[model samples]
Target: MGVRYLFQIGDQIVYPMHGAGIIESIEDKEIQGKVHQYYVLQLPNKMQVMLPVGKIKNFSIRKVVDTLTLENVLHLFHNGETDRTLNFKERYKSNMEKMKTGKIQEGAEVLRDLMRMNKEKTLNSSEKSMLGNARKFLSSELGLINGITEDQAIDLLNYRIGK
Candidate 1:
């Protein structure tokens, strides 16, 4: 028997490390002689992914945040502070783990901390790439939730974080 998916076609979901996307379809495919259910997601960046329904829980796939949660995520910028004393490797690892959570608030923290770090000192190439990924992921979700363009979402985040 194939695993059932909680999400239906047209539902909006956030795939950690991949950003937000709409569920384009659910299909059954035979792999290794066994039939499995998959969710076909179309990302905002025009990327598509096929995720096995049985592995959904392991991936942290989730629905988009509601307006109130979005508000709280925005407010995190005002209340959160980055600890600059931590070593670069340690900070990067921590931020990467947070990004993997697929939570809007966690993504906000990663972006905020990285932005602050950038102002204090130049980041290494890995840090710069992580910053870009976090920003893109956050902006994608923000755009979907607020009905704004990705560029507009980036602008709003920049304004909120005082960039």
Candidate 2:
């Protein structure tokens, strides 16, 4: 296997469970008698996430969306034409995986799907948590990419979904 480095220092990236995290530094550290280079990431809001250089690929860390694709995400959310399911656990799990891939558009799709589902009924606690996670992921990345506030990004998402 080969080591894969997807981001450089000073680049903004999104973590699966965490929101926006900036690559703070790249340094070589001795861990268990082996020297390893790692990408130090600081989550402005999370404040405590650190990732190794080689782990980026394994962890599925990735860059944000370009303008056109992000616009498509907005369209997907607004149109409400994607697939939906009534099973909360199944949907949540699928969304979690999408978020873990570090793809902004995929995360947006998950959010849109979940939000549509939520509109149909009262969400349970677990489903609510999943919704929150999806919201957090979308808001952070969308805000940074669009140069908007997190609140504004969330509002845009809600507005597009007509919620």
Cα lDDT listed for each candidate: 0.89, 0.76
Q: Write the per-residue lDDT of candidate 1 for residues 1-163, one digit (tens) a residue.
A: 9545689899989999989988999989999999988999998878899999888889999999888998888887778877878898889899999999998889889988888888888999999999999999998998898888788988987886788
User: lDDT tens digits, residues 38-150, model 2?
Assistant: 88877656475668776667877777667787788777667756565436567667777887777777777777776767788777887788788889788887787887877
Q: Give the number of the best model, judged by TM-score.
A: 1
C-alpha TM-scores of all predictions:
0.93, 0.82
Q: For model 2, where is the 10-residue window of minimal lDDT?
A: 80-89
Highest lDDT: which candidate?
Answer: 1
lDDT of 1 at 138: 91
Error of 1 at 4 (Å): 4.4
- Which segments of model 2 are wrong by more than 4 Å? 1-5, 82-86
